[model samples]
Target: MLKHKCLDQCIACTACTVQCPVTAAAREFAGPKMVGPALERFRLFDQDIEISADYCTNCKNCDITCPSSVPVSLFSTLAKAQYRRQNGKSLRDWILVNGEMFARLASPVASFANITMNNAVVRTMLRAVGIADRPLPKYAEKNFYRQFAELKQQRFPDKVVFFPGCYIGYNDPRVGMDLVAILQASRYEVIVPDVVCCGTPAVANGYLELAEEKARRNLRELRRWAREGWPIVTCCTSCGLTLRQEYCELFRANGADEVASQHYDAGEFLLEMLEQGRLNSEFIPLAGKYLYHAPCHLRAQGIGLPSLELLQSIPGCEVNVADAGCCGIAGSYGFKKDKYDIAMKIGERLFTKIKDSQADMVVTECGTCRIQIEYATGVKAVHPVSLFKQALRFDWVG
Candidate 1:
């Protein structure tokens, strides 16, 4: 049996609580130290102490800030799984977490779905059911999977597997198309593997078993390519983080370590190529002041701002890190009615910073961060890879 990792290592240093955006924004959240490492001790004895793990948001700020290297967010995630086992999940959670299922179902009638989601009556009904009144992402008429099927790519000896998470695959396929163009331009053949949701939304919503099962399934396919030394890359920060770190830390799924070792964020992968002098430097110079927001999960990976590094290398592209903290939409966390206000409150710092910057564009790897930034600051947000595609002057036909 697997034991909870590093709970004993916590010396009760309140660093995690200090860095917790949720705790700062909302008092109801019992703070990471309290609900995580502290209550975790009680949970070890089957004490079943009341925990506010639901408010965690699983942003991994605790893990990032923990001086002792304790997996604080893992404890909260485990608590959520345990809570789900005892009390079951709500309808709102079911709808929010099963994004892939809903996306597939909604893909056929995407236009209608988008219209229905924006209808005032629909918003009222969604609010009653605990979904936030904030605008939902519109479903793409052709999902990334369908678009990838029709895509014809120039063959290259080097190949990389692309894991476009549910958001890019279903909601905004243009990002995936941008990634494909960038990869192809870099002389890498892109392979869209038949992978599941990377289990982030499910894990965030407390579906531990479901998340683990999906992890194992993905590991099987990912490991096959990994063993052959093919790199697994993702445009989504959360999905990339899940593939590279969470699987090993949380599920300990077989081959998770091997797969983790080879996984890379698309920007990180491109940055590597640029550093190795393998990147295509023939770029159309686009002059603009850009602000980059590093996703919380990406920061947790301990990779030092690869997207910012890459974006800065482009001629005439002035890029600056937002450094304003978390955007507060922890996957589907902000979509919940009760948590929406807290999410917005947590995001205000970033919003204020973006508004102050007067940036021509905001660049970020996380899709939800783009949504939250645009929604809060009324600033346009584009993915770093998408920006790179634009720099390369690639015409994207969606």
Candidate 2:
């Protein structure tokens, strides 16, 4: 984020650079502290930024590791967006950033959409557009919105607005359904209103205006719910970070303060409810050990590993935290043909850890991270909520 005031506070500390996963992976990255804060003074005079802005994946590792709270990733995104504005965005960039719109279009004909999307012609066209040859996830048969409508919740006074970001809305409705079931078990009525992508993909793709526009589209509903004191919980770590962190940094959107203070990751919310003596402790013990990867966005929120803690509490579930670093797919960063190799290289450490752990499955909060893990290591990966759903013996609604 490299705000001017934040840059001014930089003590020339190499802490951020030292902790950056990209810098560790690629020597050309020029590190976070140098490219962000150090370059700001030169950038003010219109000195062409010698460093490649695209080198940054906007993973926020620098932001999280900074001692002075400088938003290193913010500066990267801002610079990239500015660069794109001056130049031009390609069709591939447009498609990746506007994933919300594409998912909606693919929903009704999801089966056919996947086929056409993967056809040889489509792959060639996608490559020409600068998108990767990587296989895209098929849209969920029924989006969570439709599934939420079918949910027959026992009315409760306490309610929460579940923010099912793009992944849950169009790709993994089961996560959302599992989330709703857990909340219902905890006696909280889940109210899922009309919402759009939180725009994490847009930010990563350097489409600031589109990202903010999508944020506005969803904030109208989020703001009203916030005003009424409803907790806005998101399962997707990227979406949670966008709602609680990015909105204020970029647009300073209304209700953001309330939302930031009140929003929770689904795992964190469940743990919080459990701590206050409200969770349904009637979990049927799950068998086998689990390897958990704490998503970078989840860690960015400054909340302790609530999901990991919760998973360990389940009887017969031996949990091992993947101690490895970022799992490369920072939003859609890994899906670009150019960056795909860098993404995989960055994830090598995590993949090795997952493989060595010898767990039956890998669990993480980000949907894209799950995709990356499965691709890199041939092991099944799932959200922590999926394990919770099984442990709680709640039937999958999707």
Candidate 3:
């Protein structure tokens, strides 16, 4: 189905080929334009080779730059599904694809689990499971749901539910905390929802049934919030995109469309607040420069540089946009051992750009991008919510 749709529109024009940052940086790797449609043909004819589908970071650059508006990322994902169906799933695939199960199973004694994960023996185990040499995030001592449950109850002018996704809820609760603080400062009643996985990782690994199950569960939960007139607010770009686009596709044949239409990212929601004059803060002078790496999913949503507008609103802050494209850390793509070298090589251009910028900090909306850029550049990368939360302190309501 991915290939049936007009290959002629491509003209083999190679606009996408040239625009691809990954192809330009990693000479060994074939560009998305070539790989996407080629894999579709590969699925048609020769289905024996278990070619590594993990190489693609799912950066969406090829789709973004394509003149034909070909959904290269979508095509690649579908092709991966076809490939995996023939080759069979790996043990590592089972672990990564069912990441929600691992997280829930580890939740009761998260600290112990965290300790074990950090241990040398466990690190080696993880390496055996295909994770690279990168350090894993420790589980928070207190999860986001528990923390939000304790917040003082206050009725506000507008209400919205927060879906912190699995990563922020368990690993980095501070992102959710800071997001709540910013929303409360803007006079919105933030409702913290009990949400599980968004299943982006599962879909990427070709676990369609598992991904569908997770999507249905999340859709029911989100639909309840929608019925209560609360828009689903998300901090993670991947989660937002999954809820907005992919979930709808999962239910498209079944004719359940409304489940996927109810999500918004913090940046898009903040931009709306700015437009509506609901968010007001005194621009505090914070003398520093920042380089912003826009996440692929965020760009896919068609909201351009709202993060830049928010950052620039901070007085005395100079925001330098990174010309370098995808950070090459597409969720857990860079964390796998086999792909780590290619991921680093693909990200080298972005790394060089950040080094040359001499910026004080790197800012991005996506948590994974923050981690990757920080790992690659050795610069403190923070979420835009943190900066806005800092600025909110200056605007004390009498």
Deviating ranges (above 4 Å) for candidate 1: 1-5, 393-398
Off by over 4 Å in 2: 393-398
lDDT for model 2: 0.85
Report the lDDT of model 2 for residue 121.
93
Q: What is the TM-score of each candidate against the true structure?
A: 0.96, 0.96, 0.90
Q: How accurate is candidate 3 locally (lDDT)?
A: 0.75
Which lDDT tens digits does candidate 1 get at residues 166-255?
A: 999999899998878777777889988889889998888789888899999999989989998999999999999999998998888889
Q: Please report, in order, the local distance difference test score of every candidate based on alpha carbons.
A: 0.88, 0.85, 0.75
Listing every candidate in turn, what is its Cα RMSD in Å to the true structure after a full C-alpha superposition? 1.7, 1.8, 2.8
Kindly give the stretch of ten consecutive residues in candidate 2 with the minimal lDDT sum: 389-398
Please give the TM-score that candidate 3 achieves against the real structure: 0.90
Give the residue spans of candidate 3 off by over 4 A. 1-3, 6-9, 25-29, 41-52, 227-229, 250-260, 394-398
**Tens-digit lDDT string for candidate 3 (1-398):** 53567454565777767876657656655777667665556656765254544456666677777778777766567667767777688887787666667776777688898888889998889899888888776677887777777877557868888889888877778889887877777778888765679888887777777788788777766777776667788888888878877777544423125544556788778878877878855555777888888888888777686877877777778888896778887787777787788778777888999999999998888877888888888998888877766755444331
Minimum summed lDDT over a 10-residue window in model 3 is located at 250-259
